[model samples]
Target: MPKSKTKKRSGTDATENRPKRSRQSQGGTPVNSASQGGGDVEARESPLQGHKCLWIMGSSIVHWAERTARLDDPQLGFTKHNMSVKWKGCRGLVFDGLDKLMDSMLMEMPKPQFILIHCGSNDLTSEGVTGKMLIEKIQCSILRYQALFCKTTIIWSSILQRRYWHYAPLGAGKKIEKKRTRVNIAIKSFILKNGGQYIDNNNISAKEVNLFHTDGTHLSSLGNSILINNWKTALQSLINSTPDNSLLTLPTATL
Candidate 1:
């Protein structure tokens, strides 16, 4: 198949329109363009290796270097690299989150054959956001990714439970936990119904696994192992069933 033409944003250079970084440049700012609805559109690329799998997500992924390197082992034929931007609560939903990621990936030296995306916990944590709305946003994001990277199989990772979610002042944390549950349900339904692969991080971490830091927003070391192992299982399942890459090619999982 021919390479898909990359969609462009306003203020993008007509010639290349690529970000300056190699794999990813972690930061708090958005890219240098504007979307149709006035969302910021910054995307940075990582150093490209010969691997065809690309993982993209928010800041939480930056800390998974050791585990991700395991995916690059020659036997697996998967090279994992991340292209994450700065994260703030609900900013991903407000901005064209996946679009930014696509821009970032295309800027890279290698195009991915499989793309895994794990994000939107911030959106779910934001107050007053309905599970339905979060579901819609995620579904739309998946469609956008498929449209741009039609040849790649997209795997959607579930939002994890925050261990400290119930400790926030005024019971705000409890509310967040509820919202997360609702959103996760919607996400699982949507992904499975749409023929996209969904990894249930919640279930994997629920079994006496201390999966988060004391702050409850990030993954602990053991949690990282659990997350990566889940990704491995998901990918391995797909590979086992589809010995020939007919409809889907597997990709790296983003945290």
Candidate 2:
């Protein structure tokens, strides 16, 4: 007898006969189907994504640096989203006050990837807070930031010089200017020793200052732009030194 011939089923028939996937049934729960894979993928990505730039202002800087960053370099990627009062009313306050301010600011916006600290001029000119005290305050701020957010790049601007040197009861005009220089020197030293960055506006001349501002105290629109531009350069320099992968390992801890 001739072998019996068998006919193959049509594709449509085979598909119709195949096992159907149930909407509610589990091969794996739909909600969790990609959970493991997605989580692993996210874990592999760097934690520094969405990091924020924070500007912390002392009393003088509250009026100066913060305003400059806001109006001049809105593009600098820093927001008043974080501010701290390191000094008060034309004078530097107690060192403890700075500590408190840093703690509170960090708690409120903890993941700052970059921090700009502007102070010391007030300390020297107003309260006569010594270079040692200023250094202590700066060191405390650095240590606190490092302990809480290791990835943050801290930038401290050098003490700015003044056009009007005499504030009654302080001293002769030139004497005050001398004090400003001393404070600026101390600030630069502290920055260098601590592995932080500094921006020197002290070297900015009277002619340059006049171009940026009408008032001796604050900068004009052009001045603000200059200030922000300098700061941007410093920020870029810091970024160039840090690697994306390494930033992920930055510590996040409570003060």
For all candidates in order, the CA lDDT equals 0.48, 0.44
Which candidate leads in TM-score? 1
lDDT of 1 by residue, 1-255 (tens): 112234432211111122332121111101011111122333333335533454544434333523343455422333233322221122233324656655665655344545657676656545565667777777777666655555555666766655443223444555666777787677666655555566666433332325444333455565665566556656655545543433433343333
Location of the lowest summed lDDT over 10 successive residues in candidate 2: 28-37
Stretches of candidate 2 above 4 Å error?
A: 1-52, 62-73, 77-97, 165-171, 206-215, 242-255
Clashes of 1: 7
Model 1 / residue 104 / CA error / Å: 1.7
Best by the lDDT measure: 1
Q: How badly does each model clash, as a count of residue pairs?
A: 7, 0
At residue 15, give the lDDT of candidate 1. 17
